[model samples]
Target chain A: MKPTNILFTCAGRRNYLINYFKEALNNEGLIIATDMSANAPALADADIAITVPSIYDENYISTIKDICLQHKVTAVISLNDLELPLLAKHKSNFNNIGVKVLISNEDVIDIAFDKWKFYQFLMKEKLTTPKTFIHIDEAIAETENNTLSYPLILKPRWGSSSIGIETVDTKEELILVHKLLLIKLKKTILYKASEKEINTAILIQEKIKGSEYGLDILNDFNGNYYGTFAREKLAMRSGETDKAISVITPEILAIGEKISLLLRHSGNLDCDIFIAENKIYILEFNPRFGGGYPFSHEAGINTAAIYIAWLKNEKIKASFNNYKSNITFAKCDRLLKIKSNS
Target chain B: MKPTNILFTCAGRRNYLINYFKEALNNEGLIIATDMSANAPALADADIAITVPSIYDENYISTIKDICLQHKVTAVISLNDLELPLLAKHKSNFNNIGVKVLISNEDVIDIAFDKWKFYQFLMKEKLTTPKTFIHIDEAIAETENNTLSYPLILKPRWGSSSIGIETVDTKEELILVHKLLLIKLKKTILYKASEKEINTAILIQEKIKGSEYGLDILNDFNGNYYGTFAREKLAMRSGETDKAISVITPEILAIGEKISLLLRHSGNLDCDIFIAENKIYILEFNPRFGGGYPFSHEAGINTAAIYIAWLKNEKIKASFNNYKSNITFAKCDRLLKIKSNS
Candidate 1:
């Protein structure tokens, strides 16, 4: 069997993914994990854990490349949203070193990472999404014109993982929180990403109250369409799905297929969709693995094994497609011992 | 071995504790967990998962008593701060039915649950703690008098977990946030707790800059001091210790002994301490099993087993005290499959 060492970058707390990949390797190859913080919990579970410079550091990419060359990493996967565009933009650098980066193209990353762009893409593609306004004036004007309503969500345009998210119940609160959020955004890590559109950094989105679903849209290395795994979010905490149950519906499956075919992204595409007013609205989509991927894995869709098989040029196993519906799972905390900084 | 069926009330997400107790029982007893929500992750880990009414409901105490009787529970423990006083106040109700509720006395619960009372207790006991002012006028006056400084923490006077906590850099921000916090506190479940002291429900505290430590002070069922296990917090997330390494210090041990002897808190007393400016300060204490218990457990302290032995009236095992220093652990998320609502 061809060695299938996997390198996970920006691996903050996805210890489950590291172990999954390790199991898939089955002692044939090693699992390498990297993060800016040496103490990131995921690092403790990897066969090899390396601490790299911050993604914004000048030597960050070079540090990653050095690790890749030294370890003979077969494929690199990023578990962070902010690092997705960086890896996608520098995919050729790894390719030149005979290392595969399992990231979508830069165009795909841009369309998925930028919330404003995501809204525009949804509009252009005739996909339903919440009404989003980039400017406070525009949002207030829409509210005045009766196009937008109260209880709007104010968040960073380039947000990840629930930073600086606020719900404004009234116009007064919206106006006040909008200013406060913009100020807070500048002090956050997202400021660097939002610097390009500092004026439109904050997004005022209509709040949709309904059931939320997380979709894992799989595609081949060639970006060919694969089956989708859907989970209805039963509970949410800290902006991530806390509890969810596997779901299979024609409407959700059809939408997932449409997104997969349109995006044609490699590996897994994690999409957040909300159903309200009997319409499916795409809240956002991350091209890489997301916090909700564990739910899909627990439901029997073994994407980690599939990724390894594809890397080894083996036929995809039918066993991986044994995903069943109504399988519920909730995220719980487990303790991991880290190497003491003695 | 007596069937020591354990019932954990308000068991929201302490799956680790549930499993720990289960392991200690060694299949000789059952772990019963209850929560207001049917989908609580901790409940799924327990042998008997139960959905109970909200703690504020009129029948809350009766429901718990009924569960204890139905499960033939030998011991009852609670995993929530707000529920601590409720359980403590009704200790005799459970005791009358021969269920040993593993909770502190009402006086200890009152001191720990009320942050203002906790601060006063620290002051009275000649223990060092952050200077706190419950009134906005007094806080502003203290700043103006040069007795206090900028960058203060404004939080609910009766705060549990990380709810309604804010930090203000300047006097202006402090004044603003204090008002905002008061308004926000009323909107939270804490409103019921803070209702009696609505006028002084917000506390402006000095922000201590230093290394934080979580100390688990173990006391037996009879409220006799057992030992103190301290862990220097390496990181914090959502107001709980994320990473910590066990540490042994004469000073910390002395403080733990003093507090344990004075408070005589039953079960585990989780205390938050800070070392800053070459002085040790007690930040707050929760008189129950805390999030940091797992770190102590992984460090070789078998408090779960100890509790079981105590309940069984067995001779205290010396092996249960085999704790060492310099052990570090970080919390990571694990998936728990929950029974579907269907």
Candidate 2:
């Protein structure tokens, strides 16, 4: 049999993807990996390693295309969420070259990136979700028009890992928070903005105070949902689950199944749901496999395996019900530094 | 008073935008428009028009930033959709030099460009929409597995216009269409693929056979929805409306209001809705102004005026309700040829 030449785009280094790919290689195929950084750890594991430009840049597409052509790459895969749009955008580019891109359309990537938009989608679908507003000004106006709620949450419409998330209780506090955010945004993103740009929008939602759970699911292109695993976040930083433990909950799995069926989602998806008042309210959906996905895999979910099998047209076990749950997994990262000798 | 130095980025010689800017200039402002094309039509109306590289390129952003600093530009506006993301990305660069970008976060622009993700959002929100799928392979597999209906439509997910759109009725036809698409993609986009370039994913959907209507709305940072106007497409080519007419439909307006209320969409947006079997299903939403929006201005719905007013934080009247129904507005173009000898 001819070997399948596969290209994987990675961010920094993804040990999880590299090891999984190696394990999944039952057939004689080559795994080529590319990253912006030359020192990426995944390079050690890959058959071919190359430095590529930032995925956000147009040149990245050209660079990847050059590599695929040179290597006779058959399939392209992205390990990061942000890279998905670029991958999807150039899917046809690969197809024209007889290379398959494991992506949906560019539109799917767009929706997946924006949390507010995803929440809006849930609302549109009549799915249970926390009350959310796109513009902070609207939330303020809503508060002014009525009375009652204190301690609402303020977040950027398209942020990840809770970059600019805050909880405010009063109108005065909200105004103060908004001012601070404007300054922070100008400093970090906008640089310095005039009065007009200072007033750019934010999302305000009725905060759900409860135990938060993450559901990991692997869905096929045919809308077949599999490997539904629910995890309780043991610890978190900046809204990302740093340490988590797999929990067996039929309710959460059912919710995951419902959302997967509704989205017709393909590939790995991480869904955040809040259990409050004995009700599950979905917060948002991440379309790509997350940093904490290894926990799910450790729980015998094998999300990566399912994705690989589906990509290769191999048979997959249809059920995940028999997998062991109530397993605890820990993930920790420490910054490394070396002293320079003068 | 000295004219406020306003810079326009990535605007080609599109006179519609220039004329609208001219009409909206209650306060004196020097309009300096930039495009890569020296012969861009907007050049004639600009106080100064300079050609620059494409906005997606990093060099273009650096060049524009330098020009803004040199010219002491006050505010920057984008007249093109593709330029919006680029402008948003370089917003901080302008801020360092004391210029304001009339855009939100770069992430917002990312969300707006993707259509399937937007549909997923609609479905998540429980909003009525045409049944859609992300990939042809997934669609075909699902149809085979679930006995899904026929007469399905296919299109490039991130594409503009009706390019590569086809309707298929049978499994044999679907397979043939998919193969042809695979071959065509390889030829055009993948020429670089063997060489490693990849580009946009394809989407397949169940055809919604019915009358389609479009709605234009303007919202402010405060999430104030205004300038709501409904127009029924009189004629369309691909996905663009070649000719359209302003119509006053309470039902359509109500739908637009619902979407705006849900998305809390700030700035200008055009929502395309399809009415089939006496039901209204939203087809898609464009975050920027539609190409045929000038027709609405002609029909007494001043979209440009409302947009500028919103930007300026000026009070805007809801004039859309006064528009008459069945007022046919048509847009047609002719190729002008000149004899060099003459």
Number of the predicted model whose DockQ against the real structure is largest: 1
Model 2 bad stretches (over 4 Å): A144-148, A159-162, A186-200, A317-322, A334-342, B1-342
TM-score of each: 0.96, 0.46
Alpha-carbon runs more than 4 Å astray in model 1? A190-193, B161-164
Report per-candidate TM-score of chain A alone: 0.97, 0.85
**Model 1 chain B weakest lDDT span, ten residues long:** B182-191
TM accuracy, model 2? 0.46
The native-contact fractions of the candidates, in order shown, are 0.76, 0.00
Expressed as tens digits, the lDDT of each residue in B69-186 for candidate 2 is 7777777877676666667677787878778776556555555555677677778888888778766667778787875678887665552422356667777666555544444444
lDDT for A184 in candidate 2 is 42
lDDT of each: 0.88, 0.65
lDDT of 2 by residue, A9-52 (tens): 87344555666666666555778889885545566567888888
Candidate 1 lDDT tens digits, B1-342: 569999999898899999999998899999999999998999989999999999989999999999889989999999898898998999998899999999999999999888999999999989999999888898889889999987898877884844546677776566556655655566664546588778798888999999999999999988899999999998876677889999999999999999999999999999999999879989999999998999999998999999999999887788788899999899989999888767
